[model samples]
Target chain A: MITVDATGLSCPEPVMLAKKAAKDNPADEIQVLVDNATARDNIVRMSRGVSRTASVQESGGVYTITLARP
Target chain B: MESVTKERVILIVCGIAFAVVAIALAAMGNPKNMAICIACFIRDTAGSMQLHTAAPVQYFRPEIVGIILGALLMALGTKEFKASAGSSPFTRFVLGFCVMVGCLVFLGCPLRMVLRMSAGDLNAWVALIGFAAGIFTGVMFLKGGFSLGKAAPTRTMTEGFVFPVVALVLFILSLVTTLFVASAEGPGSMHAPVIVSLIGGLVFGALAQRARLCFAGGLRDTFLIRDASGLITVGILFVGMLIYNLVTGGFNVGFAEQPIAHSEALWNILGMYVVGFGATLMGGCPLRQLVLAGQGSGDSAISIIGLLVGAAFAHNFGLASSAAGTTPNGQIACIACIIVLFAIALLNLRKQSA
Candidate 1:
């Protein structure tokens, strides 16, 4: 699994980071860390576009989303 | 810090350049008190679409087409062109709709608010103050963690170019129609020709992109972070446009007889208040959204669509304010818009778990 931490990032950064991580490791699972709901949604939508499934877990303001190939 | 300084310098230059181009365009046939207003042009376009039967204002604007095409070229050259969408599209639509409703009530966007003030409309002062106040409210929401989510990337570039393509088609249609139909009287007849407007738009677009200039962002940042870099550009634009207007004898100094504006002070302030608040919440003003859309932001594109539809609704339902003043229905719509926007903001506010 490839881990990309985008905590505290806003708008396009979190989505951009998650996209980079997923594209770089197509065969592995990708985990993205974000602090806002928008980033979480963006990552989830991006993952879905690539035919992957995404799940989200929240703790405090931090959100952890994992995307994996199905 | 260096990056910030560079950004500020670029913004200042762009603001000054915009003022100069606006004055020149006005001298060359663009309407008095308005050289480049995205909202006004969209309002005109809305008329052309028969969404509103406002006869004198209907025309296909070349400046808008130029803004999109200019930005497209710059993006392509810099390889920043990427088509993407995934943001909460429906929410953006609603936001855009609210934005237009608010702006039409005020008779201008944030950019035009400043421009109107520069032209000596004391009414614009009220609107500007209201805009700042509304942005302040939006800053409060941001501090409490309000967001609209991010946009996902798309594989097809065609999706990204949809707005630009439509703009191109409109440009073609404008040319074809000119052969058979004369331009409408008043504002529609006054234009700087397609080439001049396009060039002006290109210059403005490039400078704005480099500086990240946004009137709504300026107010939002001032309230949220106490940063004044963005506000400085706004200040310069106001002063510059004011001076230019005076030199050109365009300064009117009153609410009465202002082009495309009404004398209704309360609704004017309230209208901009809604626009300021909604734009601040959505992260940018209408002009800023257009620029962002040009930069391949799907959320902004959705917002633009909302703006178009909102303009349609406003005219169709007789909700748009006029030079005489806002209709009773327009006033009612303004009140309803405020309540709805505030409700949305309240619902989106982050709550502490007790």
Candidate 2:
């Protein structure tokens, strides 16, 4: 599992970070931590582009997005 | 399915409102092909404050005040009002400043660019290409992990309320023409009534806040991740304008004799390129910045200040293009801002996770 803590980052940044991680480790499941709904939705949307399934968990205001290869 | 339908409905209503308001305001004398330009209005606002002594564009615009206040009202009503601020302050200021410079070089913001196209200004179509190129470049940077960090929550609500309060003051001052300097001619002098501007701005602000509309966001999302959903509003807006113009006999074809626009293709392209590039880095366009400020973003408020000062600086330094054509100074500034923006983008890229 590869973890990217993007809790303080915004959209396109978090989306891009998670995407780069997935690209670098194609066999690994990538998890991205974010802080807002916009970032969460955007990251999920970006994941869809790469044919990855995104599952999200919410704790307080932080979102942990797990992107798994199909 | 119900929620998705609701979202689409909201987007449609917002798009229709923008088109109708834009045309109505134009008819009411808000300048041809420029019913609601945040960049232009704010530049004129700066001139009204004597930020720059540009005589032709000097006037305090009430629409700006309405937009800010209207956004504030909706935000507060929705319980989303925040003291959300403290991002990369200076960087955003510079970016905002650069965005204004870019917009002026092209003679309009994304909204006015669409409006200009609707009015059959071919220059706007050329500018659209440049804006896309710039957005494409920014998307490449995003794919490489480009970011300006994040905004921290403000310590006090007072910081957030400042923008709205100041806007209220400006709006009040706008009613008394003697208190503020206004142009007797030029675009500044041509305006809808003070009440019309305020009410129009308020409606626009509330709708924009609700819709979360950002022209740059639409283009950026489309370029970056192939998400075209953000573009529903823009598509609707353009179609509405085209239909309205055709029916009302407002359509005038060709680049020459276009109102408040120039025919210099290269500069028009380069200018909007700067706007698209800078706004993408900043996460929104000039209009979005104003709405963000009204929603209590100190960072956006600073960006607004940057826009105000930048607009003034453009006029003072002759970096602004006019209907006559792109001036030499405007040309130099366009090239310079592009170089500066690229350097900023390169310096801010982070490849590491977290």
Candidate 3:
């Protein structure tokens, strides 16, 4: 599992960071942390582009989204 | 399916309404060649502030303010207000700036391009072609995996209301500040009254939001994915505007002496080429960007900032052309913008080993 910290980042950055991290570790489960809904939605959309299933869990204004190869 | 159908209807209705009001405005002395041009108006507004002292193109436009306030009211009513910012704020700003530079060179936004052509300004033909080519280039980048990252959702009330608030402030300032001067003549002087223009803007904003109308997106979808929903809206707008111009005796086919336009064919096309490509890459047209900002898209707000600064630069340095012809510095600015844009594209590309 590879964890990418994207807390406090805005829209495209979280998705861009997650995408880059995923590209670097093809088979690893990538966990992204985001702070906002739009970023989460965008990451979900980007994950679909790469054939990854993304699941989200939110706690205390922090969102943890895990994406893995499907 | 029902929702999608309703969306399409909204889009078409908005397009037609925009055409009707735009044509009516033209007849009312707004300008024959340009009924609604956000970029041109901004440039003119910049001049009004004596930002560049470009005479004959200085006027305070109420339509811009109307676009924001109208959209704000609709969003508030519809419960779609949300404000948030993320993504590379500076990068979006640069893209906005480039978009303005390119649009000014072409002398209109994508919306105005169609209106100009439909009015028989032959120069618009070149612009349209160039715009398509630009969109094609952006499509290439998309195919190659160009992305601007994502936007995280935020507090619906707080995030969404920020831009509208700013717009409201600007509208209020527009009324009180004699600092922002209006043009005595030229395209800037040609305007409909505040009430009519504001209502027109409100109608446009409501319909556009409901329909997802975007000029560059319309062309991009057509070329890349063979999608026609957006493109159809453009078609309706052109046809509607054409008929209205004819009925009102506003049609003067041939391009010369066209309001807010120039006859430089090559530049007209290439300018929009840059604009179309840049706007597509950014994921929306200028008007769409404005609407997005009103709806609390932080990235879009950054883009708007870029647009205003770019307008300042265009007029200050003489990059923007006028009714007379293309300025000498205009060509230089266009070439420079293209070179810089390509550089950004190259840098943003993912490197691959051969």
- TM-scores for all predictions: 0.81, 0.91, 0.81
- In model 2, the runs with Cα more than 4 Å from the true position are A1-4, A18-33, A40-70
Where in model 1 is the C-alpha error above 4 Å? A1-70, B1-4, B177-183, B350-354
Error of 2 at B17 (Å): 1.4
Each model's RMSD to truth, in Å?
A: 8.9, 2.7, 5.3
Q: Write the per-residue lDDT of candidate 3 for residues B4-104, one digit (tens) a residue.
A: 46756766777787787777666666766777788877677677767767777787766776676666666667655556566556777888899999999
Q: Candidate 1 lDDT, tens digit per residue, B92-161? A: 7888898898888888888888888999888888898778888888777766656665555566777778
Measured against the true two-chain complex, the DockQ scores of the candidates, in the order shown, are: 0.04, 0.43, 0.09
Candidate 1 residue-wise lDDT, A1-70, digit = tens: 8888777444444665676677677899988988655456556656655767888888854788988889
Candidate 1 TM-score, true structure as reference: 0.81
Strongest candidate by lDDT: 2
TM-score of chain A of each: 0.92, 0.95, 0.96
Give model 3's docking category: incorrect
Off by over 4 Å in 3: A1-70, B1-4, B154-159, B350-354
